[model samples]
Target: MNQDERMFSIDVQSVNLAEYSSKGIVLDIGGGGEGIIGQLLGDKVVAIDPRSDELEEAAEGPLKIVMDARELKFLNKTFDEATSFFTLMYIEKQYHQKVFEEVYRVLKDDGEFTVWDVTIPPYPGGTKDIFLVPLEIELRGKKITTTYGVLWTKSGQDMNYYIQLGERVGFEVVKKEKNKQIYCIGFKKKTNAN
Candidate 1:
């Protein structure tokens, strides 16, 4: 199986989407629409993407296909584990918090939420200074912006903003860390915050 045949998606392989992912209704936000996990997990997933047909292929399988974000359908507290790998970088701040809020809403109490994404170095939290460095590169003899002074050059978000946003949504910061360009962000369902 080259790649398309074996059916391994970056969203799954990159984040260990199949193994660590338990047997339950795992939600894959923007799962490349191919949805390898739907098959790998077997009756344990609901793949949501803008193109509904992407998941339609897996209809015979145990996957539930949807054509929207977690907010569009599915009642609150509807999932066991939720994952957004490389998808959050594309998320806008306005809707970013809502996604986190929705994740909190959809996950059962004490459930775990994991996010895999690219971000700058110097973890814990980042200030503006860490983001203001101008990275330059040449393309076709023309200068192109490799990495901007902000997160937009990235998945369109600062590494710090996401961590803070998770806190705001009442999720206890179970763990947060960064390795090279990969950042592992973990948030547990809200409980006693007193």
Candidate 2:
């Protein structure tokens, strides 16, 4: 089949995310589109996305900025917390490490960084050119139904992958959970004992 005629639908289970709230300012990476983090945190979130249109499409609650995750414009140890809600899957795999490092640099000592993402298996040798995942996200007593589609590619993204990245970036895992293909991980920056 031709690329235009090829498509694959991924079967994903519904994920019920626990209620989360931050005490201080939160740097929400790729918090555009649905803007779930911004909706939950309100003005306490500084939501950033590389595409201006994406930020414009998000709800009017956070202080939205057009910025890249790998090149955060804030100073070192600027934010008390950071989040990536299903955002890592959208980024190129090669840039994932840089994004983690940038988040580490911008977060305060002992600050928390939470992530929610899906595990995508390596592309099977077939005619499928696109992969689509239909998700039902339950949070704060609400159910959000959406579909995320991307071009088929080799992606070995799983919970273990993020754990290693967090460890390498001087973060200790504080929370970890997985529901089917979706996973949520919380990490805290290791404080320097100087």
Candidate 3:
């Protein structure tokens, strides 16, 4: 699935987590003005991404914005729910564990982090054209891409590797599935399994 399709799945997964809402702060990592989960949210939501220019134009009240995901400027235990939809995969695998640790550190006790990212494409070793291409969008006095597809040059590892990595970082395997796509949510746990 492409970015748009993965986004739709993230929306669905986030919607399915509605039962866990409690007015706690939610942060969307790699969440560049996406995730309609905010529309259904009853709590505060934060969207953090590196694309400041593109998302700045779409920013408005309540839905706050940030410039980067790796270097989140929030204090510890400042969030209840954190998400990285179809995001962490694009991140360099070497820092994958660090990313999970940061997410784990920021969330409050018992907080949940939902991740919806692509694992393997349709074929074992094949490529699927991305859907979110760079489209020239007219916003304000500037032209920009309403759609973007940069993963074409990227190579993603197998899905199970991420699950194992999350576990290594002391996140409990709350829920995981591979439906039409790969989806998983890991809850903070007390101890690591070494």
Candidate 4:
């Protein structure tokens, strides 16, 4: 389980959350399962998830809220930093735009939104992009092969789509990292002061 956790957290580990400061608030989207980022950020993080059972399993410390990402219940410009780790794949494509809008709406001026997720490889015909990726792991000396459902957009849409969306919603792409399995993007909310 520990190895599996590390395997899934590769992208999360790439972000330097310490740069945001322990005092700053970070909203972790779909972070209730392991709350690894929350655990890393301590009291500075607020993790939200629609699954109450997962929320209950989160380690004690970070504030946990049961909510949907499509419609966040936060005031405008409320969060200094927001993060989404491998979350978009599970959501239907239609809701993605709304969720992006909500993330932009709740971030403070100059606030940053960091996202780490996988982009699907192109398939023939391009009608569908979702794929089942097989992952092998060893737990308690037994080898286990598990599969994860992944959604990949045709072409570079997986990464470009969010960049375009951020531009549309008043955010500037500050950093971009294209890793082996996942990519990371950081967008800073643009304000008149800038």
Q: Name the top TM-score candidate.
A: 2
Task: Superpose all Cα atoms of candidate 2 onto the true structure and report the RMSD in Å to 1 decimal.
Answer: 1.9
Off by over 4 Å in 4: 1-23, 122-157
TM-score of each: 0.63, 0.92, 0.66, 0.73
Pull out the clashing pairs in model 2. Answer: none
Give the number of the best model, judged by lDDT: 2
Candidate 3 per-residue C-alpha lDDT over 71-159 given as tens digits, one digit per residue, 9 for 90 to 100 = 77878777878877567756776778888888888887777787766544432234444423222323333333333333442444555
For candidate 1, the C-alpha RMSD (Å) to the true structure equals 12.0
Q: What value of lDDT does candidate 3 attain over all alpha carbons?
A: 0.58
How would you encode candidate 1's per-residue C-alpha lDDT over 61-124 as one tens digit per residue? 5456564563747676777787765566555556787788777887877776877666544333
- Misplaced by over 4 Å in model 1 are 1-19, 34-40, 53-62, 120-156, 192-194
Residue 144 of candidate 1: its Cα lDDT? 31
The C-alpha stretches of model 3 lying farther than 4 A from their native spots are 1-23, 57-61, 121-148, 152-155, 189-194
Could you give the C-alpha RMSD of every candidate to the true structure, in order shown? 12.0, 1.9, 8.0, 7.4
List ranges where model 2 is wrong by over 4 Å. 1-4
Q: Between prediction 1 and prediction 4, which has the larger lDDT?
A: 4
Worst 10-residue lDDT window, candidate 4 = 5-14
Model 3 TM-score, 2 decimals: 0.66
